[model samples]
Target: MNHYRQIAPRSKEAGGQLFAQFEGDDTIIVEATPPKWCDRRNRYNFHPSRWLQQQEIRKRYSCGLHFVGDWHTHPEAAPQPSQEDYRNMQDCFNKSIHDLNRFIMIIVGYAEAPEGLHVTLIGQNSVQLMFCENNL
Candidate 1:
């Protein structure tokens, strides 16, 4: 079974701050997209154009790195995956030709103090909390 790297609170904050990061050596590439959402509740947009731009920049910056998976924010306490989120992940997984290890989905919740923000990973059928880290 594959296990996810548990991201620490400080790393989660860093992930939130940078919002995105791409790192790789040769055989494998890792890229993470932090959650970015609109202010409106009903309209949940993940900013695809920005994500595309980030991919392009990564291609230019790193010779081997490529787009892998994405992340988004939920803006709720005790966040739970919504129907739309599930659908989107399904679409993403279906359209992807790479193996499961190459994909990742992260959801961040903007709650309150102490717990402040929480990160979760969306898999094919289940969800799991995740940990993040800074490459540099």
Candidate 2:
């Protein structure tokens, strides 16, 4: 996640989906796909290609990973979700067929871990912020 931060002057926004697995009471995030050439990126915004993301989801699911959520980067030190970001997340959660009750969204920012990461869970009827127990 840190590797995709927009730290450079010309770095465009970069992002991908998050994959995880449930173990006992824990939902451990196992992988994050890096931005691909099919994505549209600018200094202030990122637009991932849906077709490619779906392909990734299928491949990861075949490997035993579940499609847990989406992640992307922002140029700010501490990122916040833009209106478009919220809408996109909501749309994805609403349209996708999954057993989970919610989906996670992570916005990686220009600063280092925890602070630079805005983690949130978007449910059908609620949104909740999440915090890391340790420094990343």
Candidate 3:
């Protein structure tokens, strides 16, 4: 995830879906895809192509990976989800077919982790910030 941070001025916003595998009560994210060519990315925004994303979900699902979340990059030091970000994520939660109650959203900022990262869980009734361990 840190590899996709928009640290350089020329770097555009990049992002993709996150895939994970469930381990007892824990969700271990094993894949954080890089932005696809079909995705629309600028310094301020990342708009992943829904068709491509769905395709990825299907492919990963076949490999036993669960679609758990999405992630993107930002140009700032400490990235925060914009109102649009919240809306898009909520829209995904509402529209997608999934058994999970929520989906994670990760924003990677130009600075280093964990301060540079904005991690949140989006559910039907709530949006909650998540903390990262010191290992980051």
Sorted by TM-score (best first), the order is: 3, 2, 1
CA RMSD of each candidate after superposition: 9.6, 2.6, 2.4
Where does candidate 2 clash, by residue pair?
none
Predicted structure 2: lDDT: 0.88
List per-prediction Cα lDDT, in the order shown: 0.43, 0.88, 0.88
> How many pairs of residues in model 1 come into backbone collision?
4
lDDT of 2 by residue, 1-136 (tens): 7898999999999999999999987889999999999799999988889999999999999999999899999998888888788888888999998988889999998988867888888877677778532324
Q: Is candidate 1 or candidate 3 better by lDDT?
A: 3
After superposition, candidate 2 runs with Cα above 4 Å error = 132-136
TM-score of candidate 2 versus the correct structure, residues matched by position: 0.93
Question: What is the lDDT for 23 in model 3?
Answer: 89
State in Å the error of residue 35, model 3. 0.4
In model 3, residue pairs whose N, Cα or C atoms come closer than 3 Å (at least 3 residues apart or on different chains), thus clashing, are none
Error of 2 at 101 (Å): 1.4
Relative to the true structure, candidate 3 reaches a TM of 0.93
